[model samples]
Target chain A: MSFPKLWSFHGGLRLDGHKQESTRLPLRAARLPERLVFPLLRRDGRLAAPGAKPGDRVLKGQLIAGGDERLDPPIHASTSGRVRSIEELPLPHPSGLAGPCLVIEADGEDAAVEIEGLANYREHPPEELLRRVHQAGIVGLGGAAFPTAVKLAPAGRRIDTLIVNGAECEPYITCDDSLLRHRADEVLQGAELLRHILHAERCLLAIESDMPEALTTAERALREGGFDRIAVVPVPAIYPTGGEKQLIRVLTGREVPARGLPADVGVVCHNVGTVAAAYRAVVLGETLTSRIVTVTGRGVRQPQNLEVRLGTAIADLVAQCGGYTDEAERLILGGPLMGFALPSDELPIVKSAHCVLVAGRGELAGSRPAQPCIRCGACAEVCPAQLLPQQLYWYSRSDQLERVLDHRLFDCIECGCCDVVCPSHIPLVQYFRAAKGKAIAKQREREQADRARRRFEARQARKAEEARERAEAARRKKENLEKSAVPEIRQAIERARRKRAEKTDQHATSDTPGRS
Target chain B: MLALLAVCLLFALFGLLLSYASRRFKVEGDPLVDKIDAMLPQTQCGQCGYPGCRPYAVALARGEADINQCPPGGEDGVKNLAELLGVESKPLDTARGTEKPKAVAVIDEAACIGCTLCLQTCPVDAILGASKFMHTVIAAECTGCELCLAPCPVDCIRMAPVRETAATWRWPEPGAVRP
Candidate 1:
């Protein structure tokens, strides 16, 4: 398969992939551990409310925790398990924060649930298919983990192109590559299903040029499946070329507006894993209970991809990968460039986790004392978003949020490209990330203040109106009393005159005009 | 003598144009006051010796109030106010009160006497209760002004520090870099 033209993004790195280390072995299934910990909290801070109580027996694929379709992706029991307890446990984050999680002890039976699928999904409405996807708890497996159903349904827009992103450009993450090489047919079918749902004109299946096997396998699958609408295209293996915005630019040469989604450009991009998950959800009636994770690095004895169940501990995955090697020094999630270090290996995997990179000593860059930036412009030159990193760093450090905002700080994407190229060895992306948080918080505070101000004004207006009504009522009461008193005073005077006239008549009669 | 007469005539014409412009573009309200008010945190706690944020903003716009009088606004607030009013920023006036972390008025319902005093004092009407009935604070609307605290005869209302939950936990500013 060939493309008419290929485009390139502004700035990216050509780092050593180290992907072959994990792809050396075929994908294998991870054995279910004794205990599975499912953290209810998502990376975005949304909580999936627990649906099953402790001590309750649950079947595989049964919903254990529920979530809002748009915010939280529902969690299901990975295997038939008895609920141990739902309590707080350490989450998989850089901060090592504790959050509420569901602890399930697998019974080892792997009991099945009644599986159903829409054999004729084409006959159903798009909304129904979208509902099924949401029910399946599928999210973008490309690390963003945004709700796939919500992304697929772009309101008030027309989708002309759908990009099946197999471009796993991050170093040491070969989960997508393995999935494409093995299950390319399922992914293509999923792409066809997505096309029917989106009513897109054509679909572009983008794979990184480095993965010759994945590219070849996908091409064969497309040919065998007669997927005329889907084309297998190879994108250059750039560091962040897999980023939603950057990938869109590389394929279509259309820059997604800052803070805008690909759907805004008449295109929709989905990870190859997410598409395959969607296909499974619609065709096989399977919930997202497991995912393909690449457990590799110099730290582990064996480096390979494992189709692991959700809620499996990282330690278990490492143990399955032959445990830690003598040189094992650091445990990081995702790629070395973007992934954060986990404090311990006891953290459970979630739907979003694609890579578990355990780095050996000196395998990762050690922090050096940061020197003052000399305005070298190297960071700017390598910034994929083409932002002036030095200016942003200065403004962010000085708390000049207005200037940072004016420079379009939200567009930074925290890709760490600037951090990689900075001669000063400063953590520029960290600064940007911290500043972005502050900026968002400031925005929220302003919104809350504005709301309070409006409420206060409304209350003032209401109080004033109430006071005026009370005063008007009091004035009306006084006027009514005055008007009522006039009649009583007039009646008293009339009675007094009658009594005086009667007395006068009585006196005249007594003085001998008696009959008169 | 001819030049002096022309200068006097020109000044008179300029004055007439200024008067006309002022009358033709007469503004109903002081927009400066609104700008000053927008800079305020709008807690309506009256820590600035005004009835509310807008009154203090009005005073500030009229050059009658000091920029440091607001404690709820804190140092950051003072900076914002100073920038907006084009004045030098100063520390918050400790005479009014010290700046505290963001909090909300939480009513101890069991200890509440149901006097409804807080209901009347709340600037935003965040309290919901009737005479001789339990009053609960609508936490979302409560500005944590402490105005309600004083009005509670039972002393049941207290300011509880807002805890950072998963949703509200923000990334802390990065500290000094380590080698």
Candidate 2:
């Protein structure tokens, strides 16, 4: 096994991964929920315009919405059902904001439309394959939810390496780990296909050392399949190691330039699960309808790894885990570190769902009165991106947006590492987020201001031209009057002066109302 | 001289072997203890039904603690710590404190008499302003643990919830949207 160069950054909190319970449970298909609340917006922030209204019949895997040119991946009906309602509902957002959602009541028939399959991956051109990928509505399953085709489309640059991220570094996330352990062949085949599609020279699969079984299984599959170009690289088990940039850095010893992507470094990283989804899309012509979710928490009565369909309700998934052991204090949608707390279990799962944690009262209990920053350098030591989280925190706390940007606040992934390790228990991530938000808003504001200024300038120019035209017409009229024998000059001047005075008064009042 | 040298060499060799044996035979405690300690919100707040971050880390290492004991860290912290320590993270320990969206210390400027009581009591120096001037909270620094809220004699300090923006927006968990 090749040892990837992993760095120990400034600040990182070592959290309990809590993966053993679910890791032991083999992947099981979850029973379909009575109702699946399929969200129209599956890709990042952009929602697909709903195609079907309430009471419309839709088939399983049928594209319900999304025709925006802006990378809006189609949202498919997870199950054959009647469109129960098209209404604004609270998504699994951290802020608990409501977004447009499609509610489907399952008719109990697990029906799917006949999908057209390509004979082999080699038979199709790259553009055709990319189109199929887009049609399948496959997005980055590694939580970014970026449209997959956009990622596969080659830029006007040379590509050399394809990094397969199997880090599964986030705690409580065992879906990728389980997938690797169970379906190594499919993952390798997918990697091979991705290599062909991208026309990449070599592929590297990076997995953490802690997952020995997955590492061994994947390695064995690669060797048996004679995939010499693909090498299984075992990296140090570190939190956020699975992050695309970090994983790329570990495997290739390259830093994805700040504000740049892996492709910028001549590398494209795809999650192992995402590659599997791609393969399924290319080979089976199946759209991304289901995914593996690690369902485990102390509050859960039966911890298990499940292959659940998209739009399955958290309540139903939790029910399959033998229900909550006690009144769940907090229900999280993803792994704890990056996951958001669900207001209730009624929310349906999206493609990004990897783990659902039902936290119990005991688990939910904690106290650390926010204290002053002791200037502990713990945050700098564990930062996977080698960023100064503490400094960013300092600038952010002061609302010094300029200083925050100077410290590369945009590079901060908001992984919550600094906040987790702060001796003062400061919400470091929130501060950085607020600061970044302000910066983005400020930029937008500036752009809008520029636009307004331009518009005003245009209006002023128009007014000036109109004034010139009026003056010229008045001059011409005076000249013509002077040329005429009976010139009514005094009356014309009086009328023009009165009109000018009225216009000036109106302009002055509108312009300096406060001054007046 | 040769006898003395041999004796010294033998002693050195014996010392090295002893040290190696001790290291090899020593029973290793939980490696996750330090990691769990590190992942803690580290507010030093005793709201976790424990004394401090270190004590909770020790308890977690000993399997005497639940992963979700830190309310200040909220659900995300619990999940993260649970993931790190290789244990099943529970929900926020609601008995100690309910897990709500994070809030920060906010001083009501009108009500505050500038007593500086809340300022001194603040753990993270989140409350700003010198004595006799109107105090304001550095909202970013405030952990929203409500430590400063209790110290204000005039009831001027309030826990203001942090507002969400496009930057702080996270992908909603799967199945979190209800019809």
Candidate 3:
């Protein structure tokens, strides 16, 4: 296998890999919870509509929410159950807000409706295959949860490199690691399918060098699966290296354009789990109803990875992992660097619920007030996106949004690297996020005003042009009338002159006869 | 003496070019009015006691109207206009209308006379109906101008705040999220 010449990224962190606590145990499927809450929207604030309501019977793997032209992913019921109520439930977001969700009271039957899959996916057109992936509701399981089907190559767009991102770079997140280790063949099948659909020249599987087990597994699987194009390329252990653009740069030395996608550089990246889900959707006739989650932290009695049913109350899953040992004060949902603190464990797992870190009391909580910036350049040193976080913070705090935008505040991925290394304990990512939101809101407002102005100006211009046309037409009509009247007036003048001459001649002749 | 005359002639020629260029690119009306209009929430709601946002902007540009006359723009809108026009920000005019939440006109179908009065009065033409058929508000296009509210003889048209859905829900501030 010709592993593409390895490349390096600009800035990254050597984080403490706490993978051993979780990866020790083999992956297990958690027992189905009696009650589950399915938020209508995903954590990233995606818009989904609930198709099932209170007192509606739904089967496992049955579509219950979403499927809109907005290109949002559809959500399926994880188990056969009746929806008890559909209302606001606690969601796993940085902002602790409750959103509308579908609450299902399990019937405990765990029955599913028969799912159909295409036997020969190769025979079908790429669009048809992509449509099935869309119908199956597959999204990037790595984190963003952006619809995966939209990432498919557009017709005539040459997609040369398909990067299968198995690099579980974030600390304390071993779900992707475990997924690759257990189901490398399945992931390869999905990547191969993606390659076929995208017609990519090469497929690169990037895994962190720390994950020797997953790398060995992928290597063996690639050997056995007979995928001529795919190869396993292990990267150095780094925080935020798993980021889409960062991973692409690490593998191919190509930088994704700002405010653009990987496809802009003839590359497409998919999470290993997402590709696995696509494989199941296109081959075995399955839906993305469950995902592997790493339930690990210093506070938990046991740390293990569980293949959790979607909408399963996280507290129940914690109990299945032998419950909390200490008062797990900081309940973070994802890895430590970027994960948000959850108010409670009762919140159910959505598709993006990859990790549920239960930190001890005051672990994730901030205690110190923000000190003044000491002109320290520590934040700039650690930014993976190579942004000046300190400058962004100053502009953001002063509400100098124009300056903030000039500094490319949006490029800061909110990875919390600056927050970790800051001597002042400054939450730099939070400031950048707030600033980015404000900037985007300002942009949207400007766009709305521009639209309205365009409409108003167009209306005014059309009216003015119409008035000008009317005046021109009236002028032309008057000119035509004057032109036609000119000859008649001339004829009248000629007749008058001739009559006067005749009168003179007759008078002269009469007078001359008298004189003679 | 000849050289001096030549210099004078050169100055005159340059002055003519400058004058011609100035006339060729002359902008119409006050450019300040366009800037002020861009700041107004372009809802065209006429809540500013003028015909539309642009007309109100024109009045402001002429120093005939106060910047605070626009309620739809709210206080921030006034501040933006004030900052642009170099004036002090003032509270919105209550006589014209107070800054209320965004609302759409809802027609009570039972009480609707189907007079099409509301449809005619709507600035954005968000209300749809025939002369004798019941009209409904296309919620997406409704600017909540409330122009249609007064024209209804039967008082069937009611202005209601737009409802919040998951799609419209915004991320709450960190301090605002109740534990």
RMSD of each: 7.7, 22.8, 9.3
Off by over 4 Å in 1: A42-46, A67-69, A481-516, B1-28, B176-179
Predicted model with the maximum TM-score: 1
Report, for candidate 3, the interface RMSD.
4.2
Report lDDT (CA) for all predictions.
Answer: 0.89, 0.77, 0.84
| Cα lDDT of model 2 by residue, A97-129, tens digit | 667788888888978877877758798899898
- Residue A117, model 1: Cα distance from true site in angstroms: 0.9
| Model 1: per-residue Cα lDDT over A424-504, one tens digit each | 888888888779889888888889899899989999999999999999999998667656758886677679889999999
Cα lDDT of model 3 by residue, A438-470, tens digit: 776677667866665565556567667999999
Q: How should the candidates be ordered by TM-score, best one leading?
A: 1, 3, 2
| DockQ winner between candidates 2 and 3 | 3
TM-score of chain A of 3: 0.86
**TM-scores for candidates 1 onward, in order:** 0.90, 0.67, 0.84
Clashing pairs in 3: none
DockQ of each candidate's interface versus the true one?
0.42, 0.02, 0.17
User: lDDT of model 2 at residue B107?
Assistant: 81
lDDT per residue (tens digit) for residues B2-34 in model 1: 999999999999999999999999998899998
Better of 2 and 3 by lDDT: 3
